[model samples]
Target: MQSTSNYLWLLSDILGQGATASVFKARRKQTGDHYAVKVFNHISYLRPYEVQMREFEMLRKLNHKNIVKLFGVEELGSTKQKVLVMEYCAGGSLLNVLEKSENAFGLSELEFLIVMECVVAGMNQLRENGVVHRDIKPGNIMRVVGEEGQSVYKLTDFGAARVLEDDEQFMSLYGTEEYLHPDMYERAVLHKPQTKKYGVTVDLWSIGVTFYQAASGRLPFIPFGGPRKNKEMMHKITTEKPKGMIAGVQHRENGPVEWSEELPVTCRLSEGLKLLLVPILANILEADQSRCWGFDQFFAEANDILHRTVIHIFSLQQAVIHKVYIHSYNTINVFMDAISQQTNIPAPGHELIYEGHSLELDLVQQVNVVPKTTEERPIILVSKDPMTPIGITYKEPDIPMFPPKFDLINDANLAKVVTSAVHQLLRITNSLMKCQDFILRGVYWMLAILKEECRKTTQQVTALNVKLNFCKDTWMIIQKINSLLPQMNLTEVGDVHVKLQSTEDFLMSISQNVQKSQKQLDLITAEWSKSNDIHHKDNIIGKVQVLLDKVSAIYHQLKKDRMRMKLQYNEEQIHKFEKIKMGIHAKKVLVLVRDDCVQKYHKLLTSVKDWMRTACDIRKLLGPIGEQVKNLNQNLENCEASLNKTLDHCSSKLHDEEQIVTKLTASTAHLDQKCFEMVIGMKQLKQEMEDISQELQKNNMIIQSGFQEA
Candidate 1:
């Protein structure tokens, strides 16, 4: 057992152990809060002092939600050895999660996304601070349950991390053999006699390996025995280029490289997501340093997947209510078209109903559909043709209508009319209240969705910018190559130039679409805040409609722009550009450039298509809800107007009664005064009579007294 100044660490509380340090789950004596205490062993001190202090300095300087936070350093009481007190992640490392039998093939789509989001965010934080985590693997990443019970991954173990710029080089070898870059592996593991320096892109390689591991159960590059026993083979596998862009795995020491572009069959990620994810893995896991994507491109592509809207449509016409995945954008029409292709249902002959409201084909999915949809609650498809049987009976909405009419002909009907009017008013008011609450909730939901969209768009824009930067760099290289080798017949340079120019144009167009999306999101955010001040039900509905309209317009335009770019990309002679015969040096550089451009362009196009598809589903889901809100608002307004008119008519009828009551009140007042005067006179007469009777009684009493005296 080791005791720090404020913590107690026992041998039984060991969380994990590495070569240099042992992490122990400890508790603070003062607050009793659990913390992870990392105690470095003497092996760690064997390194240079600066190297030993690197982790502490990095942890102290860095503060991000996705990065493990460092508390104050403490000295082990008995040995006076410095130990790091850090935030404890109860969910443990990502390796533990992957080690589970259920996750043998890979994490589920949701879990994978969570891992991607957290790891990317952590890496982004590291990048922002000009730090490179030389060793990024599943074991180094920790997971903690958030307040909402969602798994939040954090980057831990900065022992191998350092403050290095993107272009800076380091010769020190670090990282797990399986996750290390090919150059790093050649130098460190194989002990190759080369002075090759590693750059910041090394972290990307590790991330690629980690993410690939998370997506699929096994590592990308595996030899017959293992990475450790067959080190040279592993290096060869990592360095060699297969026939196609895919991961390589060898079954034997001298066996051929087995290239696979698809994930394992047991992977829990949907086929739709896999399609988007495979390309990302292919690009990131590229052994060729020149071909591997930068952190920016990786983040963008991953975020694009994260932001994708995958809608599960339930076919009510089917016997068992089968669910199908439809990736679409623009409107419900597109969604139906996709469904039509998948299910062979005529798009025009069927209606899509979600939560009882029939979705319009022309309505945008993102604005009107996605917010209200969930896996459990899918969009219900029903056949409109009477002969075709819908498996589940589609019931009409049971919305009640209220129309109050005032009848002021007689007094008997007055009370009835008032009561009916009041009841109708109450119902309308209650409905309006409910509608208002729904509107508020809808606005918040839309805000959340749009904010996510904005984040996705921002990532896309950043990626495009990165691609633009890459294009510029490649162009500069080309220009230099041309300048230096004036006599070299680089005929392929012209095609490369044209391709780069077109790629730039495509990237710019996508960037503009992203900007438009951001602007629309800003408008929605503004409207959401403004919605609080809008008291009128009709006005609120109108505001929401306008916001949806603007969103729909922008999305349609984006879809058009994407289509145009895709067309332009398709029309290009990519095959002609692929065949380049020139000087060996020039050939390699130009081929790399061409391949990079093609790969990035395809990825961008795929991302855009995925985004648009998601946007459409989201809009379609939201459209019916928006229409409901409008209908509810209209009903509320009609009821309110009718109630007001009835009350007005009743008020007019009561005006005559009010005048008649005034006349009667005046007449009663005069009668009351006269009756008071008559009562006074009667009272005075009675008093006089009483006085006479009293006098008579007194005289009688006096006579009685005289008689008594006689």
Candidate 2:
């Protein structure tokens, strides 16, 4: 029965149960090293041996830390099952982190990037080996705790991965529908052959979705109505644009917290974060031919996007107007210059107002902007002048009498500013926490990368070391070879010298390249560490310190303002109390009157006045609420109609352009074919001309010889 107590894998509790196989945690019988064992039943799988053998071959070839390492594969007689042994990943699947922390927290950009780097590295390796992972969902990505107490993510579950051929059979849609590309779903619906080829872009699409959710804690598309309601999800994936969800979404009538404009609750997104994500998402999700990001393009473009900063610029005329967007870092003077260019207002005449006062150009360095995903940073707003095309006017240069206050309203402004500052502090706290967690992950990934590069360098160093010794030996041998000239040919001595020089040059080149690689590694590590600290420690500390002073100043002002407000409130309360006392006195006297009396009438009037005041207070709260609702309605209408119209126009234009491109491509091909034919004919004509010239030259030679004889 091929059963023995000395069997290597001791399968314990089941880790997962899939349709084709059941995975379990195992330990090596001799070594005690932990591993994962996937047992596939012979009956359940089609061509079981073929599949297992193929998987084993691919897994065995893949030597990557990010990819799961295969130890061995075997078949059991009793169970008639194919068992695949793999490295045990203790840190669990990424899905656990995503789903478990739904309420608590989300994967920060640094953390997500760390995971992404691992996944991409693994994928790149697999691609280099001519293999494709059809399934790359979060569940298939797992974290493995290494001996160094560091967690490194790895791409696991190669059951769906296959070696795709260029001119032969390629990948099938053998993955989860949710993570599948829209094209994959379309092909499935069309009942395309399983042998049809699909590119690695399917993985890119899933990566985009994963990135979107990781960064925002929200799905790019709603995970509902899958294949139901006339394949609504499929339709959405194939045709509809991804309508990104709003966080802090509230639904109407105490329903589920789903995102909708009707709910009137909007998630505030940072203008910068939005700008950062839009291009990335466009690369993956946008099905445009020219602008889409290929696999190589992702790595190329990500570094620039990671380092660049985003800023929102505003214009001021009669009212404050938002009009400009700037990328990367710039000083206030530069920003002012940008505004000048955009608004045609000279930088000298116009002043930049922040809070309730003009910003001191000199203190611009102190005003640091920290990029946040949720926070919509309010930049300096231009003052209360109506802007017009011909509205350039020079104001007399004068010193400001009062410093600008930042808030529009006095009491609430201080409270709002203080609240916002507190939120910033909270975000800093969260980011710090995430940084600590992500740093470990980053270190592990960095270590893995270093190990690979250093291994190659070590090999070169070893070779060079050996060659150095060889050169010394060869110098001794060269003297021997020279002496051997008496015994044999000395010509071999030059060959030996030339070979030695070539070897020396080769060693020098390798050494130089290795040094260059080390410098590159230094740059890479520095950049990685800097990116990991997205909100730099110094910046955060400085921001907190600035906000602390601002908050404290506002607190003192708020205290004074509260005192003044309380005094006014107290005076009104005293008047109301006096009126109430009069009303009470009149109420007692009401029994004495029985009929309509002036005192009894005064009580009724007091009751009416109290009701009016309460109503007014209610109105004050609802007034802003009503305005917001009205604006939301207007926005919804305009956005829906305008966006739809714009998209339709763009779609039509794209279609027309595609047709034109197709026509141009065909004409170009025809022209190229004609050019090729003409080139061939021209070559033949040139050959003939050459032959004719050669004959003329021979005849001239003959004629010249005859003349010489005469």
Candidate 3:
């Protein structure tokens, strides 16, 4: 987007909208660049005051070109709606591109690759900066159309982004649930004593999901109708195998997945490219964070694929117009058609001249018109009739894939030969994998059991603990294959099928064992009963301590095993293939060596083995946990006995006291009657003695003294 202004600014158009903000394309009042202004309305009260500011601060500090650039923040009148000025991306978004595609599926393999490269690069920078893009979808990825109409993708929208302080974890629920990591969703579902925390890894999961959507024009994890539809989406994201995520309509015999639906014909992806694509997808969609690929690993893996997957760009000099421009991935026919539009000449009557030869046939026959921009040569487009007068020159800007050229180089055969060699190498890899299918089947079955076990782990970890990372990666790879591989129809790239199986087996084995150990752990945890009842009795704390210790040991061992795998697995092996290029064939055709590409294929196989090994650690961490469970059970029994004894003794004492009180009451009543009778008798005896003394005192003076004494 371009802007030329010198007065008051004006809103030209609405760019987009979200729950909290609305973006618009605006003209600058001062002479400068065009920008998008994000306006936060009264509905901003739906969130917090600092929420938008946090995003602004994040963008302000981030200076990477892949990340959206922030210009300034402003407030409109009265309501004080905040407006954030930012770089205007003229190319729109990947989602818009997919929606506008003539084909149902989406962009071609080359276009997808370029966009992904930029997205990954941006993500890497964010991770390094300790930021997690909680929301990562096609809508959040913007495209910049350069002056020459070439495109570059950039990451945008920090509204859902989280800046980690000292890399601390986030416990609050944030971001779009559709793109939320499965673990994060599970956490939201199981908010009671939330055990899992959201980290930067969640961003990768969203990236993988976005990748799948871009490749297949549909989500791998479909959110269906229901009250718990969100949970269902989370479930699918977390559970589906990478290869099986985007299943095709008809299952080809021994196809990679059950839903092996064919891709749109426009995406003419080769089998060799698919071999690289599937594994990377699997790596990203891995459900287990421990087993998922890191940013560095993903970037390196992507680079490897790019090296093997070629997309040509070309330089063009229209001599009749004395003008120059570069264009790529366009065929000679398309180029001619464009020229015909520009000059009003019939495309059939025009020709693309490279080294004075017409390339009309090549342009018409190529699946997608790609140019030879990688080489240091240029081609010319001219009228087939020599008598046509030279036209006025209209110079165009240089393109990304094409450069300025005078002497056209026509060498399309090299690509064909290299592709053929790549085909043969794929067959060899496929054969190797087929030979070991039996072993892989064993591993596959085991992993399936493990996958089942993981699903059953609802007790120990709520949906929260299980985020969709590794699984998303797998889904992306399969989606790519399903969306693009159908058109290629090449049987040679069997290596992809092998690698996918390898990943599944490896993931399942490690997961199955860990889960089995976890299952044992969960059972133990359940038996211990963490009932929140106030009257409940048990040595829960002591037992939990043991459980924690036991689980930690097993978890640490698994972690150590992963580190070991990383140390041995090298993605930098691209250096070996970097320098092995063939010399130009007498400056006639660009020479390509089949041997070098073959070696690269062999290297990929080795890497696949390494990839498999990373997920192959199925070592049992169950022994200590089992022992702890036994101890907990025994401790529980002892607690039960002590509690029962104490309660029984207290009951007996209460009964004895009740009996003693009843007996004491009865004795007191009898004793009171007897004492009353004795007192009455004593008083009567005293009166009788006094009467006798009075009679005696009347008889004698001596008796008076006795009476007086009485």
Identify the candidate with maximal lDDT: 1
* Model 1 stretches astray by more than 4 angstroms: 243-246, 314-358, 363-367, 380-710
Candidate 2: lDDT of 210? 65
- lDDT per residue as tens, model 1, 377-487: 556654433222222211111212212321112211222222222222222233333333333333344345555654554453344344334334444433443343354
Per candidate, the number of residue pairs that clash is: 18, 12, 35
**C-alpha lDDT score of every prediction, in listed order:** 0.61, 0.49, 0.48
State the lDDT of candidate 2 residue by residue for 172-274, as single tens digits. 5677665666667656654544444566666677777666655544455453432333343443443445343322222233333343211111112333344
- State the local distance difference test value for candidate 1: 0.61
Off by over 4 Å in 2: 1-12, 102-105, 146-150, 165-171, 189-197, 223-230, 242-274, 287-291, 303-710
- What order do you get sorting by lDDT, best first? 1, 2, 3
TM-score of candidate 2 on Cα atoms, chains taken together: 0.41
| Model 2 collision count | 12
* Reference-based lDDT, residue 457, model 3: 35
